[model samples]
Target: MPKSPETLLEQEFGLIAELVHAHARARPRHPALIDECSRVDFGELDQRMDRVATSLQRDLVDVGDAIAICAAASVNYGVVFLGALRAGVAVAPLSPSSTAESLATMLADCRAKFLFLDEHVAKTMATVALPSGLQLVRLDHSPGVRSLEAWLAPAGSVPVPVTIEPDAAFNIIYSSGTTGTPKGIVQPHSMRWAHVRRARNFGYDNEAVTLCSTPLYSNTTLVSFFPAIAGGGTVVLMPKFEAGKFLELSQRYRVTHAMLVPVQYQRLMDREDFDRCDLSSYRMKFCTSAPFSAALKADILRRWPGGLIEYYGMTEGGGTCMLLAHQFPDKLHTVGQPVTGHDIRLIDEQGRPVPVGSIGEVVGRSAAMMKGYFNQPDKTAEAEWYDAEGKRFIRTGDVGRFDADGFLTLMDRRKDMIISGGFNIYPSDLEAVLFQHPAVRDGAVVGVPSREWGETPIAFVVLRPGATASADDIKQWTNSRLGKTQRLSAVELTTELPRNSIGKVLKRELRDRYAQASS
Candidate 1:
């Protein structure tokens, strides 16, 4: 890791502000951002960010202050984020729909001095007494709270010299905790740029127009956005993901690239309106967050021809494994290979390297790996290791196996594995079987505590439009495809399965609910 002061202004600038400024100078008149209501050129974006930074400095929010961004995915939110980064503040983007209790907990945990709340959420926040020393800054529109727009009006655009450290905390993205309170993952500016460099090397170029259909607060979105900006690409922002609108927007903007979840891809393919749109503009499409079934992968390839790419990574380290479009023929199920500059290993509980075709925990050493969990040294220490050979690695908490060709195949999450009748069953295997049913639109598998088997597999399924399937029928379908140990003991038909903002199944919630009911 290079020292922050010396590395801050390099080609791969460590500071987020430097990334934005580099693009602004290179492409001043280029369209940098486009939301539903507004568009900003690189020049305007740079100037606005300067003004926002000036306002924060004038308000006495000095360098190293933590700022919480709680706004919808809008143009203003992006501006505020860049400004805060430029002012040398650690920016934490809070989910707009997070509960007041969760918000309060996160705010206090991060020790944020300024809270930027969207108008709708601002009103709800006002009813609750905020912790002392925290200032509420309203975004978009709200009464009583200081508006971001109002604050920027008097602050003139004068570029301030910001001293930045590459290793300084840049952002704190809170993970959805399954066992306890959500922990904030502390990512440094240099780590972010490392991913950006990797992304650029993977063919994201300056002329690319990247679409932002995923939530801006998502890890995938951050990975794509920073790289797009650093490479002087335009960002087409969507406030939320809507299957119909997403297809249309891609054509409207001639979007060159996009990142999507498997569910979104399924929904888009099922929509009759999707085929009518001109989707030829998309050149590259990356899928992450969840595994796309082989059939779904084939469908996507058939639909988009050569545009699909599959990547496997976690928030702790970005782009650990990627299966490029070219490698899909030989390794369709593989998460490609370890990305460049990353060392991947599959190790057993004994800390020895597992043989090929054997499942073990996936560990990686990458330049883009996170520094550690925010304020959680114990957890960090538990997650990382230094081998006798002097190599450092971060355990992924995911179970995977490598093929003879060195391709990685994901088995299951270590925490989500089901033990039924003393046999281990991965939920993904059951979920894949359930998705094979034509009537099943979405499915999630969870292990419910059972006195007889120790743990029993249960499934929650959502049906397709106008398709009604009973739980027994779905269970029968799953049983036909899976072995006895992997088959679901019970199935529940629901309108929808609960998912986090990033579209990951909230299996922990399902497990708890079903475990309680069975007890």
Candidate 2:
């Protein structure tokens, strides 16, 4: 018989290096990564990573030192990431497209010592003044920067030895905070392996050809990548997600699995180019970050005719719940039941468990949860807790409910709820109704300040190409579906909604922009 969730986690937790080494030995000849530039096998990947490890040691990089990686998705980035972890150094992978201000803030927050940047990003970084105690190295080319190629040059000898513990920090992923400054969610080596185990159970297998359309720096990519590697599968990397190119690559590479946000799906489905490419190669499709409307979900199922999976999670907690296509017929809006080893509960504001079907905060305990925020003990303590049963659970800060069948239906973020004319409305509920319109491609409902109501919802919409619809038309469409108080008072049309690295709509940024324009 298989071990229980507690026993399985207890035994496997914190052994990332060992796991990777084992995979290297087992599947050395297997294709590990395929990018636009080249494809690398496990044997080559292992050898390159070892060389990177030796280089870091030669540079006198101490254990636990922060190594920031600022590059696009490539084989070099993957090798450097694994090498840093193997050398017992904390890795922070920042988006290559990030602004100077954002990059500087993350560098200072993590106290990163050495940076590995792409040639283009290096040129940009050279113009900015770096913080004290920092040194920059180019992954491709730059002056005074150690090139990744030169650093990994043929060296038959290994350097100083390093030891890594399960609980030790592995990586710091910066969260896209809706309110405050972005916090670095510190994940340990063991938690990463746990993520791999969970991902394997979630459906990544040896035969899977996982498509890497999302930014590798995001948690969605990290969770998917490690498992694909563990299962001896190949990862097809896309520099960035472009709807037409995405479909072409999927068919060309025969990609069997993929992860995407709802907005991407909406955009792809609306494009005329979607019909020009073949997508029958995709077998597994997963989405996260935000809820998808029933109409959108139905459209995807009709288009792909493949498995569709929905996962509800945050940067802090890897994945709390998952709903698969098999379960969609009945639990259409549900985020699915808890995976093995996760204990879930919906609680009221007073910290008491709410009755079934009551809207409340969703909290859970799992092996995939992050260790804590880096160097922020108070924030960590506030977010983490041990239940009366001694199971560790992290507060999700999302308002949701469990149905009689024990499936979870997320209502909205507690902070995202809108109040208008002394009435409360959930943006997701309103957005779901708006998505039913044939003209709407993608939409985000945000609370804008109002003179009468404390805050009213204003819809920002992206219409389907060649499908024209006015703001008033959409407003009337929503008003018919929602209550008088829940109706949107205004609508704005845009080509695209502003999104962060992970494809999450930055509602706060939208609100700020609207406020400025109105003032």
For TM-score, the strongest prediction is: 1
Q: Model 2: per-residue lDDT, tens digit, 194-231?
A: 77777765556657799888777777788777777766
* Candidate 1 residue-wise lDDT at 47: 88
List the global CA lDDT of all models. Answer: 0.76, 0.75
Residue 202 error for model 1, in Å?
4.0
